[model samples]
Target chain A: MKSLRTFIPIIILLVAWEAAARSGLWSRIVFPSLVNIGREFFLFIVQADAWEQIWTSLYRAFGGFALAAVVGVLLGMLMGRSQLVAGLFDPLFSGTYAVPKLALFPIFIFVFGIGSLSKVALIFLECLYPMVIMTYHGARSVNRVLVWSAENMGATRGEILRRVVIPATTPYIFAAFRVAVPVAMIVVVITEMISSADGLGYLVIYSLSSLRTDRMLAMVVVIALIGYALDKLVVLARDRLIYWEKLDTYYV
Target chain B: MPHAQRLAGAGLLLVILVAWQLAALRGLPSYLLGPLEIARHFAAALGSQELYEHAVASLLRALPGFALGTLLGITLGLAAGIARSFDELLSPLVFLTYPVPKIVMLPVFMLWFGIGDLSKILIIALACFYPTFINAYYGARATPRILVWSARNMGAGEALIFRRVVLPAALPLIFAGLRVSLALSFIVMFATEMINARSGLGHLIREAENGLRFDLMYVSLVSIAILGYAGDRLLRFSRRYFLPWEESHA
Candidate 1:
């Protein structure tokens, strides 16, 4: 019941949208009816090309996200454990952290080509900073007491890392994942919208150009659902794997 | 030790650049310009008035959106955090839609606002809002309850308590949010320009790409990189000045 109350604003917005669509204040092209948008959305789901576009986007996003996760965690862990490594890489990461990596997408297209590879590479680069930074914080702050206790028990370094460090840093990893997933989606969509002939972003641009506002809104809906679903999937996986800590926010 | 480490980092960068330069010396592809060549082209571009015009266009779009978004986001987010009524009305919407990329609304914005800098600026503002709002919300909410109670006991009014206690405590997180939003504003600005624009660095790069002007492309890339890096440094310097007591993350 409480959760249902949280959706009241969204419902109200939807009603206002329907009213606006029907009020004759604007052209049908400007404000497509909700029913028309719903129908287009339904039709979109059944279409093979729509599914392919979604798949293409998902493939790039997940591919880049997965790659960033692996490399970022490793680099972060290394930096956290070794002052030398930290000194070398810390400035490099933080100095460039606020720079929009998307600015390099053009160069990436040249370097990696206009295919999925370039998009994935940009996504990976964009997602890497958050994952690395968050994991570094988490790994560096792992309680020294735990490490000491493990060592006093004659545990090997490998065992200490496995039993204490990884578990302690899991929450931060998930936090980083929460941050990176949206980034992955953003990079993929931006890249597709900028250059690609495929994917949901391209479909949005295509639909708009063709003066099918309803269809474009439908595509936006599809993209939003994918983003929301991906976020929920991350939350679900985090809850299952790192069940000890619940995420405070929807994504974080 | 610090000197050695700095030298090592610089050396690593130099090695990579030198390797690329040597590869270019052997005749690389049309697309891949050497670092030195890129630097030279960037300098040449900087000498021209066109680069300045494009840079100003990009900056105008990004900075105004960033300022507007951060201002609104910090205000609304702080209000929602403190006031139950506002929280009930606003936070649900913000949190629920947080994951959706704001860029997806660019088309709708273009339709509503017209296909000009207005739409692009608004879209960038929308993108910048989420991080600042979320961070500021959490920042304000996370303020120690004891401090608020003590302030109340001292006969401080609501406004006084908020201005003196809550805002100060929340400023760090607000700064964090602003940093994120600044980065996002640039990104959204670039993306909007790339998707549709007659001006800005994104358009310059695209034009260069289509024309096969490798030097122009490299110049644009280097220009953007320098702009991004310089913006970040300026933010850090301001943060240091404003929050002198706060131990910033390196």
Candidate 2:
């Protein structure tokens, strides 16, 4: 019953959209019919060129997200465990936390060239923050009672970290993943839209420029579906790996 | 004790800058400006009117969008949290679309709102809306039931309890949402300008890149960094001012 209630708004939105599309008071460019959009989406899915663009975007987003996951976990763990490290790096991260890293894209283009390399690097930088911050909070909040009990049983440093610290921090790592995945998609599309020869972002721009509003909307749908799918993948992995914990947050 | 730690932090930053300057002396790419050179260019730009024009243009878009989005987000989110019917009606849609990249709406917004500042501002507002709504929703729902009961026992009316009990409890998280939204506003504003605009810092950097004016590029970079950092500081200051009873950690 609750699940059915949730679908009401979505259904109403779609019906309204279809009605507006059929109204004809507005240009098709502004309100492309759902049927045309569905057809364009089908074409987009079947085309080899479209798949290549999707692959390019997926690889860039994945490459950056994977790198951030590894490095951010390590750095965040260190910062959480060591006060000295925290003092040194906390200000650095939190200080520039609100600054738009997109401002550095031009410089990155000059340094890393106008290709996947620069885009991947920027994505890596952006994803790194949430990962590090969340993981740091997670690791720092691990129960001292657990650590003391483990030490009393003669567990070594490595064992304590592996058994106690990591298990406790797993939930937060997943939270960070939830935040970073969409960010990876956002950065990839934004970078491609700003300046790129290939990727879904570039395709959206290309379609818009050539006055194919249907194709552009189709690309938008594809991008949104990919973003949603990536988020689901993260949740699935988190659920499988951390079966002991419930997904308590509304987002992840 | 804290003072010494702060000094140590400053010392570390100084070390990084000096090291960068040293590396540049050995010769780096022309595209990369050393710390001293960036400072010089920033100072020169500060003396000119051009930087202010671009900065103001960027702010005009970011501020209005941030204000509008957060205001609506907080109001609707609180309403949904406090009222079950509203929650069932609104939250499902918000959560379903939460993971989708909001920036993809830019082109469509351009088509509907026209190819002007209106589209860009609206896009930024749309992007800014999500975080604030989520945070405020959680904040309102997380309020302790005991407190609400106590307020009611004291004969406080519905509006009184809501204003007194709900608002204070939610302020911290709401501020957190605003911080995230403010940062997002700058990012979306920069992106829209970069994708299509005649003016703003993003456009200035694009022109500099095309012209190969390395100094101007660094100047724009420095200006943006300063703006972002300053905006964050201002937000933190206001948070402290408003929530004096709450202790801030990091």
On DockQ, the leading prediction is: 2
Q: Can you tell me the DockQ of model 1?
A: 0.57
Model 2, stretches more than 4 Å misplaced? Answer: A247-252, B1-4
- Which tens-of-lDDT digit does each residue in B144-244 have in candidate 2? 99999999999999999999999999888888888888888999999998899888898898999899999998888888888889998998899999899
Q: List the residue pairs that clash in candidate 1.
A: none
Give the CA lDDT, 0 to 100, for residue B219 in model 1. 77
Error of 2 at B25 (Å): 1.5
- lDDT (Cα, tens digit) per residue for candidate 1, span A3-110: 888888899999999999999999999999999999999999998877888999999999999999999999999888877787778778876787778877877888
Error of 1 at A154 (Å): 1.7
Evaluate residue B187 in candidate 2 and report its C-alpha lDDT on the 0 to 100 scale.
Answer: 91
| Best lDDT among the predictions, by candidate number | 2
Worst 10 residues of 1 chain B by lDDT: B1-10
Q: lDDT by residue for model 1 over B34-122, one digit each (tens)?
A: 88888888888888999999999999999999989989999999999899888888999997788898899999999989899999999
Candidate 2 lDDT score at position B197: 88
lDDT of each candidate versus the true structure: 0.88, 0.90
TM-score of every model versus the real structure: 0.97, 0.97
Q: Pick the candidate with the highest TM-score.
A: 2
